[model samples]
Target: MAKQKKGEKAAAGGLREQLRVPAGPVDLTTYDTRATPGFDGSKDDGKVALEGLGAEVSDWQERLFAEGRKGGERSVLLVLQGMDTSGKGGVIRHGAGLMDPQGLKITSFKAPTPAEKRRGFLWRIKQALPDEGMIGIFDRSHYEDVLIARVRNLVTPNVWNRRYDQINDFETELAAHGTTILKCYLHISPEEQRTRLEARLDDPTKYWKYNPGDVDERQLWPDYMDAYHAAIERCNTPEAPWYVIPSDRKWYRNWAVTTLLLETLRELNPEWPVPDFDVEKEKKRLAAT
Candidate 1:
């Protein structure tokens, strides 16, 4: 998709335009996660946008729950795939903060357990699949098998290549079972990532977030980029289209994610069914009792 000009209307024709960024390094701090005109991070405007978006999310969630109670067969699965410092955690934290905890589940996939390793690569992932009337967010998901494993030479090229078909089939099965998969790739530049990493090291409260190994991963940036590009090209399907979110600007990432999720939930149009009961009859029965 071609990059979009800033401040354009967000209709279908404008969607492609929204994805574009200006050439060269974009400033990360100028965008505000809480603001609608996120290009400028005004606190008051940001707060208003955040509150409005939060209210909309809450409304949709309530409707979804009601629809689920009425036996509606709908579920949403959001997969967040990115490099080590790509702000996946931050996006999940802020974008999903407004959701009802009971209706949402987050799964962060790590190195496979021994039992998982013995089974197919997708075995562990299937266990985290969302049930009806819920949203499931996967932090680092099944794509790791095709991406990191392939980049690190942990799997044969043939084995990793086959995972494209495997993942597509898995997602197809989910769609058949009323699950809609929304995948997002947070795209951050190397320099922006370095700044975040340094901030983690400098801030005492965030010291735990600093892992020296993350720096090591930075060395293989090109390899990982290649892996991600290939994985996205091969695995992005009609059942699950991947949205490449530009993350050099953190606020824009948050806004884009929130907007996308809101749009998706709204499209579901979940609603509560009217209860089948006569108020007068109920009142008469209560009076007799």
Candidate 2:
């Protein structure tokens, strides 16, 4: 769990180091959507692996939560982003579901309200940050300002352009205050997305998850890619790094993210806080009663 040096190869095919967005330009095409990097397993194996993490991850999260409750300042923020049908919900359901809900703060961002726009994009985001010792999960996050906002012209070029620095500064501030930020771009191909969308429509149970607007957005995939490229290239820093999760295989995506969470928890190594009172005295008083 040692932090790898800048140029050093990650030990054990470390997913964080293996999947990290490299310095310089990013070409999404270069990353294979179906790849299950660092995992030499089939779909069923992936599922079992994820299931296997349920207890260990849950235990680590409880340690973190206990620490936070006992006045620890360290927290974790996991940012998830991708095109429609990239399985942001799936990750939460299969990965985060392994952990205690009390230890997690999950937010699913919708379009900004008129009131929110007045306050700014990050305003609501700041409010949702996890308390010390907790893990905060963003289903979609402030990067939307640079992603959807830019792609849709929600703001002027000059405005959106300046926000990247604002975003970086904000993340820096979060890191300075002990937030371990993990930004994941759930990488999925257009074809895979279409297939997923079609499945949603075909299954009556998933009808509510489908949206006609997603199709409209799909047509502009290339433009969104450009915006994502800029956002990742501009805002990717040592404090808040980006990891591209190859997401075509649902099982792999779920397992990989869960694995990343597990590794991060291991790296954090949050210990349960010790009792401040005299344990023997308290036990004796109870025994006497």
For each of the candidates, the C-alpha root-mean-square deviation to the true structure, in angstroms, is 5.9, 3.9
Where model 2 places Cα greater than 4 Å from the true spot, the runs are 1-13
Q: Each model's TM-score?
A: 0.84, 0.95
Against the true structure, candidate 1 reaches a TM-score of: 0.84
lDDT of each: 0.75, 0.90
Residue pairs in candidate 2 whose N, alpha carbon or C atoms collide under 3 angstroms: none
Per model, state how many residue pairs clash: 5, 0
Worst lDDT run of 10 residues, candidate 1, spans 1-10
lDDT of 1 by residue, 100-153 (tens): 788888999988888998998988898998777888899999999987899888
- Which of the numbered candidates is closest to the native, going by highest TM-score? 2
